[model samples]
Target: MWSLFALLLGLVVGSFLNVVIHRIPRKESIAFPPSRCPHCGHPLGPLDLVPVLSYLLLKGRCRYCARPISPRYPLVEALTGGLFLLASRFYPPGVEAFLVFAFLAFLVALSFLDLDTFELPD
Candidate 1:
């Protein structure tokens, strides 16, 4: 059950990480504009934003404009979920696990940023 909880939390965090990856490089505020379809600029609603599930349900296309969505979104969510599950299994319940999670989050963020900008931010 704890592993499942961690996986869910990872998925949610991965969703936020997508926002961070897209907005941070562009100097945009992550909190102001909600997640939207990049190709169409459509403001995504709840159903359109459910991590990996939404991508699958929409057939990897935007609900509003039928634009092909990037597969990276679901890939990041799955990767984060798997990492969280792995961390839960390896680290005992304490500060160690928390530190592992924090490290993983930074690595993931840096990875996406690299993919976006072709360079890591200094």
Candidate 2:
């Protein structure tokens, strides 16, 4: 169904948003260098990057470093997925729902960035 598709899409986008939230304020390129374990700077492989499920399966620690990962990662992914499902119900399966998803995603990024840095990026 459209709701399921939207939720999955949101989860994937939320994963990318993690990179955005981490690199944007630091003026780092979001596209290059790929995702890594922050504690060890080891490039993360596919199994290490499965949104909320990976965090749960790994028990919230980096596999490479055994350091605690922030719970915010899964929280954001779930929130985005929830928002996408909600938007799909409200706006139907069309461009409007897609726009709503984009807006909601932008807001989520802004919110976490503000919390993490005490300032919002331009």
Candidate 3:
């Protein structure tokens, strides 16, 4: 189903969003250093990082450090997945999706940065 495909796509994008959310605030390079746990500095294994399912299974805690995880992880995943489904419903395909996705990503980053740092760098 197209909806299923969109959801899977969203999940992947949401995973990248997690990376962006973590890195952008710290002024770290999003590409390098790889994904790791913020509280424990443990390199997160695949099993520990499966979008919404991982957060649910782990009860929103780091497996390595048992630190309470932020609810933002699942929130981002759900938000992206829902947005994908909604966009697919409203728009056919092509540039509509790309444009909306780009804007959504920017808004997400801006919202988080404003909430956490109270300032927007970019």
lDDT score at residue 36, model 1, on the 0-100 scale: 79
Q: Using TM-score, rank the candidates from best to worst.
A: 2, 1, 3
Best-fitting candidate, measured by lDDT?
Answer: 2
Taking all chains together, each candidate's TM-score versus the true structure is 0.92, 0.94, 0.87
Candidate closest to the true structure, highest TM-score: 2
Which of 2 and 3 is the better model by TM-score?
Answer: 2
Assess candidate 2 and give its lDDT. Answer: 0.91
Residue 84, model 1: lDDT of: 85
lDDT per residue as tens, model 1, 6-122? 788788888888888889999999998888789888899999999899999999999999989999989888888889889999886678887887788779989989977887646
lDDT of 3: 0.81
Tens digits of per-residue lDDT for model 2, 12-41 = 889888999999999999999989988889
> Ten-residue segment with the worst summed lDDT in candidate 2?
113-122
